[model samples]
Target chain A: MSCAKPLSWETLVDWWAADLDEAGTSSVEEHLLGCDVCSAVARRVAATAEALRSMVPPVVRPEQLAEMFRRGVRILENPIAPGQTCDFHFPKNADLAVHVLGGLALAPGASVEVTLRSLASGTVLGHVEDAPFDAQRGAVYLACQRDYAQLDHDLVAEVRVGKDRPAARYTILHHW
Target chain B: MLSASDTVVPSRWYRLGSMMTEATDSALLAAIAAGGAGRREAERALCRRYAPRIRLYGLRHLRDEDRGRDLVQTVLLGVLEASREGRVREPEQLVRFVLGTCRNAVLRLRELEGRAQPATDEVLVAAAGGEAPRDPVNAAVLLRCLGSLGDRARRVLELSFHEELESEEVATRLALSRGNVRVIRHRALAALRACLDAPARGAA
Candidate 1:
């Protein structure tokens, strides 16, 4: 039989986010202990959250990046200065494949975009338009998971802002 | 549209809940605490009911799969011991008792993991979680789902989980109200669930 008393997804998310209070927590646990159906739903929500938790977006803020370090997520940080080139070797069991594009003179409050394109064939590997800027270092951090990293090809970060010319460019060589 | 039916439940749980002779939580506790011929059976039933719940608690608090499994066994053993010793303060409120035990266990675990002085007197909020299997969501499929998310949804998730930020911090960072963040996260999670539930194009 289906669960007669099902908790809402919003409640489950709040529970996962630690947003629920004492009464809410008890109610969920009580429901879970009694209703197998609701328990199953809660599991899916958790699994989905876990999947997202382990993933590294195309771009992340410095604090988010540091949180990965705190979580022991192995990151292969490729810091390449604009107009400079460095190779990438995605080590085994790597979680984050980051390319820190440094030495940009972006105007404050300007939206940064990093369009990754292959150097040899000029094919666009991926276009990550949402970038987090480090105003102090004048850098833009661009990243994705290790699975998205292509091997044995030099690529360029065609950095730009909305409807503007290239602000800066960084090159990444291939390795591993 | 995301409801309890959105994902497939393990058959074992269904069997546990559907058994005709199943007793209520209070009855199970009374039997276990009363101590007699029906005690073992009651304890087994109790474990069947709450093992998954406690494991989920461990997953949320401890954040490790092995630890989650450990918690299921540990809590079951603790409950059994508590029943045998007649130490269950409120047999009627066994859910709270179990939850309290789970919290204490997590605090002890944190202490062992080098985070000194687990809070003994702190009033903890009851934050329940879900049963996490060894292989949960398919990573590749989930990545596709995440990629299909809108910028705002994706950013909300990133802020919530990636940065481990609370609702207020996430709201401040994303420039959305806390209520808005919750709604977006809920909708985005439902969307991801839909994508995850759909048959993979390449799957046979």
Candidate 2:
């Protein structure tokens, strides 16, 4: 609070990002340690960062999936082509169940969407708009807690690109 | 962002603190030095205000949560002991003391890891010192806020924070420029903070 010109959110975020050069880092910490105003902002941002790190979204990126594997987390990946009904049996060691909806011809500049629905109850398990799609690989990935899907009912992942209707629907029949 | 060029510091600040209304840091330091009945309470008060900053410092610099917690305990203990022995001449400079202790402790830790790594004079040290009283964010609220973001923003944060990816790596994975990634990532986090701060304001 002693600072007349306090650090902005952008600067604090940059600090939170921790990607700044050495000088940038020093400047931020120098001001942060001295300026109570900036310290308050940085604290909230840091807490949010802590929460974000612990969070596992329904969707994940390739690097995230890879990191999970590196951490020794077991994953059961079911690669299903469009309109294919894949029978997935989650191994006892599996922590995550991934459904890769492949074979979608994503046109350039297309906004991809993914929906995970329960086949029996018609419950929408999850939905992601602006899903990150691999245009070159022609695929979209949907992941969920493996233990949650150990049931008699089937689960289906539908993928759509810049369209109201799904271009690809891959069904997952979970066999515990 | 305050670059290395923005060096108009008021003082070498170690006074960045919380729980300010109850007592001044100098008072707390004086209490500990006197070793009266309130000495233990004063030490706890001081630690409560500064432990979060030190823990955060340990986490980012040492790159380990356990190490961060370790650093907080170690540094606070040093502060407490030094205060009791009247070794700390300037109670006002505890912030500087804590920050310096963290660096020293970290250096000792590095030495223990086998031969000191090159002190490449990296920014990791300063960036990690960002501190505030530890606040527990509501998990349900955070998830709800997270659910509001676009998939790209959420993925960006996941990769950056959880996966511990550099901006360059995240940019490469998402096919975004490094600057773009930083902007998007912070904006999402800022919104989350705003949302969390909103209800607290109303309640308060």
Question: For each candidate, what is the lDDT?
Answer: 0.70, 0.70
Please provide, for model 1 over B1-204, each residue's C-alpha lDDT reduced to its tens digit, 9 standing for 90 to 100: 755655445554455445413787777777777887667666766776777777767777777766676666656677778877878877777777888778787787777873323222111101112334324555445555676788789779877865678989999988999999999998998888788778364121
Docking class of 2: acceptable
**What is the per-candidate TM-score for chain B?**
0.73, 0.62
Clashes of 1: 0
**Per-residue C-alpha lDDT of model 2 across residues A52-88, encoded as one tens digit per residue:** 7755566676667788899988888878898889877
Query: Model 1, A28-141: lDDT tens per residue?
Result: 876665577877778777777776776656556787778778988887777888688776776777776777787777677778787777788887655665577777777777
- Best model number under TM-score: 1
**Which residue pairs in model 1 clash with each other?**
none
TM per candidate comes to 0.68, 0.60
Q: DockQ, in order, for the candidates?
A: 0.33, 0.26
